[model samples]
Target chain A: MAASSTGLRYPSNKKTIYDRNINRTKTSELSRAAFAYLFVEMITYAQRRVTGIADLEKRLNTQGYPLGLRLLDLLLARTASSATTSPANLRPTRILPLLQFIHTTLWRHLFGRPADALERSAANAAEYMISDNDPLVNGYVSVPKEISQLNCAAFVAGVIEGVCEGAGFATDGVSAHWAEGAGGGEDMWPGKTIFLIRFREEVMEREEILGRAG
Target chain B: MRREWEGEKLPRVVFTLLIVSKAGGLIYNREFHAGLSKQDTNELLIIAGTFHGVHAISQKLCPVPPAQPPPSNIPTMPVRPSGIEVMESANFRLQCFQTVTGTKFLLFTEPQQPNIDGIMRRIYELYCDFAMKNPFYTVEMPIRCEKFDRGLDGFVKATR
Candidate 1:
């Protein structure tokens, strides 16, 4: 094979992924079915040769990690290019903006609807929760009867971790948990998923300094 | 267009569908009408592979070269001529549309069916939503999305 100056080989079409614009299409919507099938496959792949539920969930999360990293750059470029909404040249320097960006912009992009709620943890200052009622992925997947503890949305959590890491916000870990009947919620909306995002000590410390600066 | 004052029916049937991956592997196959004779899965896979090869050769066999556009600063998508789009026989017809990403949709329909291209485009749309966007779908692998099946069922029913 003939090699280019850079190691990346262009396709027969003579176009590289770099030649294409990532943020070109905005109005197109993804079918929930696509996400559902993908989620099921991810679970199936992770379930193979697995020790326990936690290990399976961890594998699913790891699978989605790189997707989040790529989306972080793509989405930031999208927001910066589209000037109609709030200022175009915004990169999330602080924790609040980044969280808000994920809660609103990223959620809407992925799920077509904004997250149900975003709340700070009462007990842990570093922990934040973003909840979605009847997540699109969960809507179509009926978890098998055997492993009831598995939350397929852990893949989404992995994506959030990638975004946070890409955006320079280090986190202790991000995870997905079923918030069924917790905190006096989801009585009307069952299968509510709460994404628990916990920032590292350094992140909270930096937030402290940033808050003082403002 | 025929007058629809009777409120009877519109189009005909989509007998079957075969999806070939960019690499020419048979990724999906489904039968809609019960009457159409079925081919063995192995036979279908070979047909798909054969068609992929023929499609590639057909592009090279084009008698005339496409005229180059005036030089421009912006890079453009390569405008290669498409391969065999429609094949007609005394009994049924085969309609094919290949996506830019190289995934091919082969739709078999009744010979008299109209507006097959529109239906092909719609099928492509469904594939984009259900197959391409799927995170677990390794590119060029078999597509097994329940939503895609449901969507197709609904679409075919409504079309009929």
Candidate 2:
């Protein structure tokens, strides 16, 4: 009789992570109601302040800013790992590219699509508009009658603001609004948020000089 | 690329991650993979509920330290309870990880799921990385973090 080993042997043939292929069969999914209720509580939690809509929006934005900082790093790492492209190379070293990244890559990553449009106001060069058809954060939030002007996504706008500021842009303020344009619907879809990004006038002057010098 | 293993039929497995509060409320839930059986889902929820109760009781039952002496040499360490359990049924295994703050993560997967403890650690890592760090994420509330969910999905998919 042949002697047998007491310990059970495991799979000895192990492959590297890079050699692994996508398991398309196993996908991830989450419930929407859970998020809605959570966001509702967040809005209520922020409502305890003794101030106006702007103050409330400000509080919400402050809450989201730190997240933007962390996401900037994590997003770059994830994108860099999977694809051949280096995220650090594609990273925004200047202001315009950063804003473009926010409108395109960052928006797409978070909300499953890119922002609808990005345009610098013809009347005010300092002001740039970043529009989204449906902002995920503000999807279920219904601002109370007293705080009608408040768009709860001001929290996410704040995060974007924090990200921009962290990236070295001198930002005046980041605000979210509900638009009744041709793209505006019901509780969820009608939330056409326009993140009004106002860069400091000095920053624009620097951009112009940089453009001329380059 | 290894094309030989692509056609190989491995045992089907799935995972569902949930965060339950001390009061037995569902704080966060995400199906990290889709191949889980219905029995697994029900078992996972039950496991989550049961662990939530156990953790609460454990925290309360934790004994307080006796009054300390004024001895300058000895440092008084706080007494706390560790609420962690690995539960297994016939179909799947449930790993319950709890933090000192009373937050718990319930991870359900195949009974023979390997590196499952590592997955739980990474899930906790993502919680710290995304959820706790997220300004939008309120303390002890259900996580509404898109990044946390996405990151967990990406990690599980990548490893699988």
Candidate 3:
């Protein structure tokens, strides 16, 4: 209840993050160059004393995880704040709706556009893929040939992982993979990235139980 | 009016921008215009270190303002010395803009160039966006970002 050292006094009533208005300000654009520079610095910092490319990616993913968690609430709050919508209606209960939320709403909020495609894994029922022809985060990045397997989009994958976990959908792991020229050479997006999201077996079991009840 | 006319006659060019960290390290050094001859990397580092020392000493040399009795109406913030801001030479002018966090931006420009303050502001804005916000940028380290370079180039060129 006491005032903090910075002289910021919050009322005795504790205000939660959700209590604040999310849409107080209209949509604003940030400089992409700044983001790229910061991302480059992040990569450089992560690369320091790292054993391999995988370790660097893990660091990037960890950095993005918190952002994803925060964004999930903010994005949903924005949708729920609109006059016509209720919070109940906005809550994504099913896997399909959750994926749709990420594919359309989350992508649009972060990248200014919807994902290129959302697909179910042909080989695995537990997996889903979100494709971005050219992820904005990777726009200014060029991975070295020696670390050819490394994709900076792992940060985005971490965000996806955060969103899934925050939404009560337990996931085993989320990974980013380069799928360049998958849609043929004619496609404009050459740096195509596919984020493979795999749900845990417990989540699948819960979904099956809920399916029968619904 | 006279200054504006003179400014128009002489080309407005930003020769270079050097960023010195709080710890007296040269974190970023970039040259925009090709006019100035490049200095050795060691020389640049020495320059940064010397400037940092001078800047700190200059702050100490500043005379303390006379204290006034607390007023009921207005809140007063503590005053800190703003060290050497500008250095002028025969051919070029050097302007220094220091941030609240002690990062210094030194811009070398044409002697007659106008609105150096505005240029400094934009640069700071770009730094905040690209460098500070970047999750990967650690404090007090060299910045080697293609985007930051490209953006700085575009901004400077567009202004010209």
The TM-score leader among the candidates is 3
TM-score of 2: 0.48
Q: Which residue pairs clash within candidate 1?
A: none
Per-model TM-score versus the true fold = 0.54, 0.48, 0.63
All candidates: DockQ:
0.06, 0.02, 0.10
Best-to-worst order by TM-score is 3, 1, 2
DockQ of 2: 0.02
Candidate 1: residue A29 Cα off by (Å): 3.6
Return the lDDT, model 1, position B132. Answer: 60
lDDT of 3 by residue, B8-66 (tens): 56777999999999999999999988777789899999989999899888887876665
Chain B TM-score list for all models: 0.83, 0.71, 0.88
Which lDDT value does model 2 have at B47?
A: 63
Model 2, position A127, has a per-residue lDDT of 88
lDDT of 1 at B100: 81
Lowest-sum lDDT 10-residue window in model 1 chain A: A1-10
CA displacement after TM-score superposition, residue A147 of candidate 1 (Å) = 2.1
For model 3, residues A115-197, the per-residue Cα lDDT tens digits are: 99999999998999999988999876645456778889999999999999999998987989999656573255556899999
- Candidate whose lDDT is highest: 3
Instruction: Give per-residue CA lDDT, model 2, range B1-160, as digits (tens).
Output: 4533643455435478889876676778888666565455566568668777776676576576557655778776766666547778887888888776777778888775668778888888788756764435667676776667667888888767
Residue-wise C-alpha lDDT for candidate 2, range A86-180, written one tens digit per residue: 64445576677888888877786666678988988788888888888778776544444455677888887988887777777778988888775
Pick by DockQ: which candidate is best? 3
